[model samples]
Target chain A: MLKRVHFPASLLPYLLVAPQVFITLVFFIWPASQAVYQSLLVQDAFGLSTEFVWFENFEYLWGNQQYRDTFGRTIFFSVAVAFLSMSFALILAGFADRVIRGSTVYRTLLIWPYAVAPVLAGALWLFMFNPTLGIIPFILDAFGRDWNHYLNGGEAMFLVIIAAAWKQVAYNFLFYLAAMQSIPRSIIEAAAIDGAGPVRRFVTVIFPLISPTTFFLLVVNAVYAFFETFGIIHAVTQGGPANATTTLVYKVYNDGFIGLDLGGSAAQSVILMILVIAMTVVQFRFIEKRVQY
Target chain B: MVEKRPGFTIVAHIVLIFGVALVALPVWITFVGASHDGARMLQAPIPMWPGDQFFENLRQTFFGRGLDGSRTAPVWMMMFNSLVMAMMIAVGKIAISLLSAFAIVYFKFPFRMGFFWLIFITLMLPVEVRILPTFEVVADLGMLNSYWGLTVPLIASATATFMFRQVFLTIPDEMLESARIDGAGPMRFFWDILLPLSRTNIAALFVILFIYGWNQYLWPLLITTDPDMMTIVVSIKQMLEASEQTPQWNIIMMTALLAMVPPIFVVIAMQKLFVKGLTETDK
Candidate 1:
């Protein structure tokens, strides 16, 4: 990784890396190890006694109906989010890639949501979907349909997914557009000359060619929906309507902080950490494979 | 330019326009919501067009107590807190990452790879997963309700460091040798040569990280229990929770606008750099 002509081994490099190393140890490594350790020890509700029970927390999570439901719900949430946002972005990117003129303007208009914080995005969506006074509900009322994310569990999941997916569309779109643009024009030109229509070419040529970007975005978006959308879940529903929207990450925060259930929360945290590690490994492995393409 | 298919081009434009409009609709509604008076906002079928109370809402949100019942720090104070937190995080991450990446690429340090892998571990352990213990550590250190608590724990960024490392690796080794030939120390070369060369990258990364820092939700929410120390982003949660009774749509929408505006401005104004930064860091 280093240059051939590197500086000799010295104390200066130690000083240079000290800050990052220190922070990593203190904030990241320590907390992570503590989570693992805490997961093994269950404390009484009164915070009176602690006992080391090996894998009991994990077993408890596996057996608990709500935790299991949250796990399934999280996978469903990520899949739905990844599918919705990616397809939408891919469609927009597919179209945007065709327009020779005003593509930059289109991109500028489309990607500003990337800068919006997820909580605020949640707030905005919550505002729009507010049952009594929201504009969307008003529109839905005219259509003879009800829309309120608050009291309905399915609707709560749907709303959070939309907000989470909404913010992610910009990121996916940028990547998809970049990936689309990087394809050599001659291939598309030859396909067009061979009488492949735009849809046909996109399906047969562009889509497969950009599978690497698609995969990358999939992993990125899944990790995003898993961890980063905590704000959206927290602000929008608080894992509400009886924990219908409780992702694993949100459950960790809720159990630990709000519910004050340390063992359960730490166990959930450890599970989420394992999931992250797996996702990171998968990302790196796929990234290595993508380099071959 | 693949082929001049007029029908397809028309269709493409329509799709893009529709997509843009869909993406822009929420912000447009929020903007409209922020413009009307409180009573108007409370009414059903809130006006789709902007009303004339924009400055009045802005005045109330910015200068006065933010909402009716919530005793929050003034909107400007929270925005300033967000600004300070964002700047610190961006600057802090860039500074330390530049140092560590420089050391890893330029110096033959012992455990160089060890340090690199150690930093990489942080990527897998996000604050959400380790919230309780991290919060306990911060509380044990008495950093809660402080700027350091808000910014520092979250600043150990593996992505930024890796990006800089990649940037440094692309630089010719001859630059380093030539600087050594001139008898300049490593820090001097870093300050005078490397910093200037990577200025654009630094700026690009700044745009991305600034948004990241500004948009932090859970950490700031957990750490800054004191309302005075709350970030604008975190304050939205507070406003939403507190306003469960007699919700003030106008003021809350205004605050959401306040929270999103600066970062949105950065992304749009620095669109090129933002794109560059995003592609590089994530890769």
Candidate 2:
């Protein structure tokens, strides 16, 4: 990773690297270690005394129906978000890739939402789906359906998923368009000369060529849904409507900061750390494989 | 060009128009909300068209008391806090990452890999996972309710460091050799050659990092309990909570618009750099 010819060993290098190493140690390593330590210790309700309880926190989490439900809910949320946003982006990119004109204009219009923050995204969707005056619910009311996400758990989950996916569509669109644009046009022309229609060509050739991009986007989207959607969930639902919308990350925040359950929160944090490490590993592994292409 | 079917081309344009409409729906709604008075916003089936209250709402939100009966800072102060946080994070991350990447690539130092791995480990431990303990650490250091608490912990970015490392690696070895032959020291060479070479990448990364910093919600939420230190993004949540009582849709929507405009403008204005930085760094 370094150059063949390098500077001689000196204290200057240490000084140069000190700021980054120091910040990482203090902010990242120390807190992570503290979470691991605290996961083994249970505190009383009054926050006065603590007892060492190894694996009890994890065991308790495994047995708790609510925690398990939250686990399932989080996976469902992530998968739905990935599927919805990716499919929509795939369609848009497919069309945008076909156009010989106005592609840049279409791309510019489609990609601005990537700049929006997750919480602001949440706010925007929340306003659009606001029960009394929201435009969407108003339209749904015309169909003789009552719409209230605040009171309904399913609707709350749906709203959060839509907001999360909406913000992510621009990102996925950019990647998909790039991947599509990189495919050699002569291959598609050959497919066309074989009497294959546009749909057939796309299904048989274009889709297979972009499989790597699909895989890469899958992992990235899962990570986005896992960690980055916290703002969307927090702003939109706050894990409300009987905790139906509380994903694993939101649960950690709710239990520790709001519920004051130190051991449980720490345990959740440890679990999340494992999840992140796994995702990062998968991402890097795929990235290395992608270099071959 | 591939054989074009008139029907297929028509279908493509129609689908694209629909997609754009779907994506722009929420922003349009927010804009329409911001452009109306409080009474108009409270009415059922809120107006889809813009109103003439845009300037009035801007005045009330920026200079006037933000939301009725809510004891929060004015919109301008929160925007100022957000700007400060974003600038500090972008500049701090670029500065430290440049220095460390330079050190790692150019110098043969003791524990070099150890330090590199330490920085890499931050990628796996996002602030969300270690919220409670990190909050405690910051509180213990008396950094709560301050700009440092808002920005410093978030500034140590592994992605930026790695990107700069990749940029520095691609520079030919002859440049460094020539600089050395001219009797230029390491820092001088870095300042004159390396920094100049990486200027475009730096600017591109600044756009991405600035948006990231400005868009932060949770870290600032945990640290900045004082209303005066509240960022516009965080204050939107507070106003949402207060809306349960007062329901000031106009002011809240106005605040949301104000919060999002700066970053959206940056992305649209620097579209090429944004796309380049995004595809480069994420891979």
Candidate 3:
């Protein structure tokens, strides 16, 4: 990746990379190694000493019903969030791609929510669903279906999913729209000439063509709902209503910081690290494929 | 667009309009909710239009005492903390990324790829995944409750460095050669040539990183237990906690509004650069 006529080796280059390397070492690399090493070390009952018990925390977590439920719940939450946000964004981008007029205006209006922090999104959604004074419950009462996320686990999960998905729609929409814009106009025109309807053309041509973006957004959204939705889960649910909304990231925080189960928390952290590494590998592989063409 | 179908165009327009409305609805609700007084918000039939108590709520949020029992920082002070944290994170990330990218692209050195891979690995290790150890590290360093504590650990950006490396590689090699023939030093060449060329990239990355830094929640939430160190975003959670004791919807919504406005304004104002930075950095 380096240039051909680059400068010769010197201490200046070493000095230049020193700051980033030092920060990365102190913050990322060191902490990650700690998570891995500590994952294998179990503390004694007195909370004074630790024993090097490899993989016991992970095995205990695997056998624990609550941890297994949290793992399943996190998968469900991430998939629901990814599906909802991506589909909504795709529909909007498909429509926006059709209109020549004021598309930029629509993009501007649609994408500002991306700037709203996840926690703030949770706050806004929580206010509107505040049960006693909330507008959503008021409307649901008119429909004869009760809505109280505070007591209902399913409803709490639903609330976190909606808030998390709503924040992600703008990001997904921008990518889908950009992918759509980059597609050649003549391909669509050719499909129209072949007697294909608009929806059929999109199904057969446009959607397949943008599968790269779809796949990329899939990994990105999964990474987001896995880790970044910590804010949403923290603010709105606190992984509450009987722990229905505790994703892996939230669990890592809850167990590590609040629970003080060091080995268990570190095991969870190592698991999450493996997850991130897997996702990153998939992403880089996809990028490599894209670069080849 | 392929055919002159006005019906299809109208439907597209309708769908886009509805999508836009759906996206904007929560924000509009927040705005309306913020404008009303606390009692008005707690009652039924929250007003559809803006309320007359906007300035009152703003004043109360900025200068009022604690809401009933719980202590909270003044809204202005929390936002200022957020501002300071955000600026430091954005500038720090760009500065470190630029120097590292310049070195990687323009120089041949020992352990170059080793250092590059090390920086690149930070992308996979988000603070959420390793919260305990990182917090322990920060606490051990006695950096808790400070701006350095808030921003420093979050500043090692793999994406920014990668993006800048890509940018520098695209620049002609002749520039460096000519600068060298003119007796320009490495730092001088970097300062005079590379910085000017990558100005837009730096600005674009600033927009993105500023938002990234501003929106941080879990990091600041755990580290800054002190009231004075609370950021605006984190303060929303505290305000919500206080709402259990005293339901001040007006002030809470106003603070949420205040917490979110600056980043939203940056995105809107720098829409082009934001789009460019986002697509490039993610790629």
Candidate 4:
């Protein structure tokens, strides 16, 4: 059957892929290579001196206290955001699964945040958190606790985390909701017939069925938190008050483009690539075993 | 004799209603804040009602900025730039992904699996990892501050291609064979039969891509240095980031509202297809 298929053996893959590959190679791959190459050379005010400095840039960033601190903060930010958002998504998805009616309403509302463009999401968060005029501050003041994100690094970090989680939890919920609904109704019915209550049924049957989805979302959410949070981060804090909000990606941007330290930025980018690769590999190696087809 | 659990339903409704309110709060606040006068927006009690400043605020934002420091450019011009860039990316991604997916799924070719894995692995390398590299590339190509620079790199969407391939795989081989026997060329068969059969998936993909395309911020922000070339997201951010000056929340809110309209409509219009796309049922 396979041999009988008329395959355009010579022309097909090349024809199909030429345009995408061309664009990617020129636009994606070329630039990525240049970034790495740029990292290996030292450039001066007169222009790039182009002398290869093999591991100097990476060494400098690794040993630099500021970059190291930002790297630590970036890890903490990504992990904290992923854990908080995914946990909330899990609880909300679980709760919504039980509702026979009004579930659509819950789903739509939950999904609403996902629909808000990232730019708008940042703006909304900023408006709500603005100190003198922000709603969050007003509410906090009403409760008698003074709130400020501008001058306080911890407060700034907390607010950024909340904003990031707010934008993402809805997305995670949608995926979880779909995965939960995919569970066989008969399996749940059979479990119920065996005197399993909601919690018991969830723990034994539903959890197992949704394990794959959870694992997939874990990797997906972690990647997003690591990379995509830059928009809101850039918009809201600009890596803020005392550099508390400066993430690895933000630093890459700063060092390469803003700081004009192209070599330093490229080095940071390489490290980020390594971190993502490592995290993804770990996720697959460890979590893949827990997931069911 | 029935034991009534009326309270459970009431409690559920209450919870759902409150949850919905919380979710909608930011969107609601944005719209309301956009309409209020700028000074009024920053007052003690945040304005909860829509004001009369929408048009004035919008007009000021769009026409207020100039590119060469000589004359001001229309806000619509910036919107146009963003729209064009987004469309290029969307169209390019869809067309390429469709073709690659068809070839991968239907045709047996050497290194086919390898190509599939190569593209799919990119799904792991989140866009940020490639930024420094991508920037250097654009700069080398002299595409910095240009529209093509904004679109091309991003058009390389492995995820979309993967989705299309998966959808195409579900089509029965018998149909394709029959088409071949009837002398419908491969391209003809793909366009006429396969495409029609996959309408649901196509619609779903369009919505997904449109939302993704519209929400793109960082890549565009990095590539385009000229304000005239800026997307609404970058422009709004520039307003917020003005050093030593109080950022105008009202105008920023207004710009954000305008930016959000496209994706929101795309979602509402294709709402059914989106849900279907998310929950793919096995035939």
Q: For model 3, what is the alpha-carbon lDDT of residue B83? A: 96
Q: Each model's DockQ? A: 0.88, 0.85, 0.86, 0.47
lDDT of 2 by residue, B6-81 (tens): 8888899999999999999999999999999999888898999999999999999998768976778999999999
List residue ranges in candidate 2 displaced over 4 A: A291-293
Model 2 chain B TM at 0.98
Say which docking band candidate 1 falls in.
high
Instruction: State candidate 2's DockQ.
Output: 0.85
How much lDDT does each candidate structure score? 0.93, 0.93, 0.91, 0.74
Global lDDT for candidate 1? 0.93
Better of 1 and 3 by lDDT: 1
Error of 1 at A205 (Å): 0.9
TM of chain B, each: 0.98, 0.98, 0.98, 0.89
**How do the predictions measure up, each by TM-score?**
0.99, 0.99, 0.98, 0.90
DockQ of 1: 0.88
Residue B66 miss distance in model 2 (angstroms): 0.8
| Docking category of candidate 3 | high
Tens-place lDDT per residue, model 3, A1-293, is: 88999888978899999999999999999999999999999987669998999889999999999999999999999999999999999999999988999889999998898999999999999987889888888899999989889899999998889999999999999999999999988999999999999899999999999999999999999999999999888889899978888888889889887888899999999999999999999999997776211
Q: How many backbone clashes does candidate 4 have?
A: 2
Q: What is the CAPRI rating of model 2's predicted complex?
A: high
Model 3 misplacement above 4 A: A291-293
